[model samples]
Target: MSRQMCERPDCGRGPIDEQGFCDVCDRPPLPAPPRPVPRDGAAVRDGAAEPERTVRAGARVGVAHVRPDPWYGLGLVDADQAPDVPVISSDPVAEAHRFCPDPSCRQPVGRGHGGGPGRTAGFCPHCGTRFDFDRPDGLTIAGRYDVARVVGSGAYGAAYLAHDRNLATQVVLKALHRSVAKTARHERDVLVGLRHDSIVRILGYEPEGPHLVLEYVPGEPLSARDGDRLETLLAHGVRVLQALDYLHARGLLHCDVKPLNIIRFREEGPAGALDRVRLIDFGAVRSHTKDTGPVVAYTRAYAPPETDPEHLRPTPGFDLFGLGMTLREVCRSRWTDPATPGVDSLRLLLDRATDPERPWWRFVSARQFAEQLSGVIRQVVAAAPTCRQVTRPSALFGSMPEPLHGGLGAARPLAHWVAARADESGLLDILAPFSSPEPGDVAAALPAPLSDPDDPGVTGPAGGALAESRLALRRRDAVSAAERLTAAALPDWHWLSDWYRGLVALADGRPERAAEVLNQVRRALPGELIPPLALGLCAELCGDGEVARAHYRMVFDTTPALGAGGFGLARVLLLAGERAKAVEVAEQLAEEFRYEREARVAAVRLRVVVLPGRARPAPTGEDVDRARAALPGLDVDEAAAASLRAEIQYAEFLRTRDRLKLSDAVRALGPHAATEREYVALVDLANRLRPPLGRGRQGRRGRTGRSRFGAASGRLSS
Candidate 1:
């Protein structure tokens, strides 16, 4: 077959089949003649002198382009068709210095080591050009950028709208005032080296008479204009998060992200104009080093208490806290009633929004902050990392039988259903896994209930009444429950009693104590699977992966059958880094229990194992049909049935869309409706499935400080 011609100019060689290029031009296959070299020797080859053509091409393609640039490489394009060379401007250093802003410098206002005030001042003595400061209007330092207009100003310095005469493009210049120019320039030098889609682009900087001329961003700040409301806020927040996600992925932190710092491009729309937001401003950005000091510029209300002196330490958690707070503001702006309290007031209110007795008061932790905000700001805030227990799958939310609540006088519809079916025998059989055995077991459980019933008394064991009263105390407030649970007697008092004790410890911010008590219960009652499951939970809360995995394994191994409960356990195990074992257990459970909840959770986890990092996968048409067919025979309550249907439908969508993996699809179940345990399990599963990819995401790594889980457990068990 005849070979194709190279696409480059000035070459006529046949295309190399493998590279799709000609030997001379090395251009991809094309049907045109190559352009000839200019007759004038003065004509530059690639925007450089004739001799420098090779150098310019080398620079454009990177260091490997030097020498004959080994034809070892494949296809190439014409010089003109090649990617544009990265523009490299003059170095700010080796230039002259201007009068120092500090009083100690003593040079005259407009005079310095450099010829002109603008040029000298822009160039720092220690560092070179102050890229962080605005350039002087009249001076042409490097003959590339020309100062146009001042865009805005803030704590850092003035931002300017400028034109790059050479590049023929408009850009925004952010520069510190003369006083902060030196330090700001130093910071800019470091920041400009980073490349991310979300971050502002850094062109180049020049010293121009006591000032620094820097590259300019062309978009408007998000704070500009009005009209756009909820959608605008959400879009802006999403973009900011995406940027933050990118920065975090690159190991950089944009510590100064805020509404004002974000830029928006105005595009004409049907009614008016719409703003597209993009994150800008990196003067305060850092490389996220281990030695990061207390961050100072973080806004007070948005900043979590951990950034406070009492909790002075900066972690990715710090950035997450800010992100959560920003999300709350955005969501509240849309969701909250305007009459009750506006978004601004809510922020102020939360500043003093103390419930010292409540477990949530300790918002010093980022996880706690994220959880609290997630509750109120449903749409914007990502799931809370700490409230994992509150969102588990097997949680006792609406799943409990109706009449059962009549025992506690809390709404008995579920208990009544249980009672109506109580004589059915089949109903009891269906609930056998969840119920305790023997009349004595029921009687022992009854004493704590019959005692005070309402106010079982206090935490101490004066009698059965006291134990009931102590449990009652938890309903009042986290502190009251914590106090009571801490005083309660030893093991075997009640299964739920121990469970609640663990919860009390968790609520009290004592995760270690909660883990201890929960672990003890797990050890004592291997047959009672809840305790071991809960023990795994406590270990998870304390960020102890090994311990959590062990406890979960115990539950999986000891449980007689794999059903929704066991499937849930397997899901958690899979999340905790035991994918192989999780898959094994999940496969077993899928064979026996075809319950929608179990199957969905198992399927989702399996997908995670199959394709990690992708979004939650949708169940296939076959999976949906299978789930639908099984639904009629499933013994789940009506409400649960409805939920199961929804989940199945979602799984089908995942299968069709092919966006997420199985584990992600399973995690898409969201939080449990009522049971804190199920909610926690869900959170733990999500964590395990996809360990936080970057700074703002959640993870279980290198946990050295006081455990937030430990504190939460202490509060619960206390």
Candidate 2:
């Protein structure tokens, strides 16, 4: 058989290896040449381009939609208006303290001594190295690119604005400095195969000056303008993560991911001008598989502290660390409000992304990073009252079977309607709507964290053991679950093992232990919301209202799609006697799609419910009126509606001690009783609440040993 020639360009017709790589170049063979299609729709030969299909307007490569959440520009205030592009100086002057381009001699050369003006062009005094700061004068690169001026410079090289003579468009000529010349071909190879929208495109490479011809992105660095929303900056961070994901999949790493390498500009969309970001400058690009040597090109400020620039291994974590620092730097100016909805989540995300501790603790994949970042963006956008973000289910956690709304979301029980009792003052106290559910119920109700497909523990016996343990927990067989967890030989540091242990503890009603174990998972996956959510439940169970509040707020403020977080936060806030804040939480939750009805009911209840003897202040007249007005229009069953009305009327009765309000409350409870016996009991309670025929409005103020529904209650018991 004839030896196949490698199809890679400029490979000098190298033989193709069994691995489909060029033997001479050690790179994957380039894709087959595109065949040309006749303009008249006639097929001439096999070496022709495929017929183009009609793609939709918003079509994209790889995935239909890369970003799950639509970009909300500047907190919904300037979403329709694109950010103004910074005007680039065509003829820019070099900085005064310009350094030598040589890597070995980076001493400042252009600085003025005493009163003399700095020389724009000179030799470095310290190392006798030639340095030039003068703008390119009539410089034409590769006969096709006309160099204009130096746009920017970095550790690897200086980028110049140049015009492509044949293409009639502007391009960037990244002239590699002499020190980084060896990486020029590597950077070229990395850029040639990249075709992501957020990634800058490569046109051609010239070997004479060793320059990379790149698509010119006319924009400023990823930055915060005045009035820029923090969400906008985070949105750009998410896009960078997407681009990083693409690069990492191809075994390439953009080792230097900084704000200057990301270009932000405006792109006209169907709605309006949209803010867009592009990842540029692949000078630091290296193959994670092949380039396992010393780490050379990285900004110290953005690089991981644990990594030595001279000898760090090539891992996705290195790039992720740089991205985290870049986002932190760019978002610092816009993160003015510490109380901003997604701020806490964003902080947690960056913390996990750039964790200086064990390498495994940081974000492992770009998709994982993007998932949390996108969620944070949703929260920041939804925090604005004028903005309504579309709710999407969590990819990390399964859907919750219960709303965990507690008493606020449900009607009063049949017994509550049938066996109501009056206090020593001949008045009945209204049941608080914001009562938290039993801790055990919350522990059971929280959605389980989904197994990560990328996790090694997700396969073989470890995965089977986990599934079996979860099934046992679901069956309420804590012993069996615990046994399975103990028997399984999982690694000590495996997060899945800790997660199952927490669940087992929770199932066994050991919330304190569960809290401890779940907190470990939180440390393991700081970007995830489930750990904090479970911790919130554990805290609530332990009656640590403040701790629960903090944990719930972390999850809920990040993404209301996790409805359990919202309900838990509201319940904790209610228990803390912060009624207004609790009601606000519920009202905000009502704005989200899937939890709308439950949250609406909770909001109504929160405005009026008062826990007996808890020192919780009674609802105001405005609160009562709003609750009453909202109750009738609520989308609930007749019994639930009646129960809600009864609660509202009972609240009014307690406030004013009005017989009419008390009677309305009693009448409203009729529909609440499911059985005839319960109905009769409710009627008896209503009769007992009535005013005495010969007594004043206050009646005889005295303690009664007999409960109001004592006879009916005894009858029902019999």
The best candidate by lDDT is 2
Q: Estimate each model's TM-score.
A: 0.35, 0.73
Best by TM-score: 2
**What's the C-alpha lDDT at position 136 in model 1?**
46
The 0-to-1 C-alpha lDDT of every candidate, in the order given, reads 0.40, 0.69
Q: How many backbone clashes does candidate 2 have?
A: 5
In model 2, the clashing pairs are 35-47, 35-48, 35-49, 36-48, 36-49
Candidate 2, residue 486: the lDDT equals 76
Q: What's model 1's overall lDDT? A: 0.40
> Residue by residue across 1-718, what tens digits does model 2's lDDT show?
7666766467787875432334575443444433444543323355653322211111210111112222222233345547886777753334532666555655666777798868877678888876556766566767788878778876666678989999999999887654556788888887898899899999998875578889988888888888677766777787788789889988988888989889998887788888888998887788889877877777778888745342367688788888999988887776667676667667777887776766666777787677667666665666665354544444444456477776667666656767667654546643444455654565556554444534534333454455456556656788987887776676667677778788888888889999998887776565457788888888888889988988888778656877888988988887777989989999989988888898999888888776767487877888889998888778998878877777777677667766545654675576555566776666666656655555445543433223334433322110
Residue 528's lDDT in candidate 2: 59
Per-residue lDDT tens digits for candidate 1, residues 488-560, read 5533443335555665666555667766666544332232334555555555556666765655554444332
The C-alpha stretches of model 1 lying farther than 4 A from their native spots are 1-141, 177-182, 209-218, 223-232, 245-253, 266-276, 286-307, 310-312, 317-718
What local lDDT score does residue 420 receive in model 2, on the 0 to 100 scale?
69
Residue 560, model 2: lDDT of 81
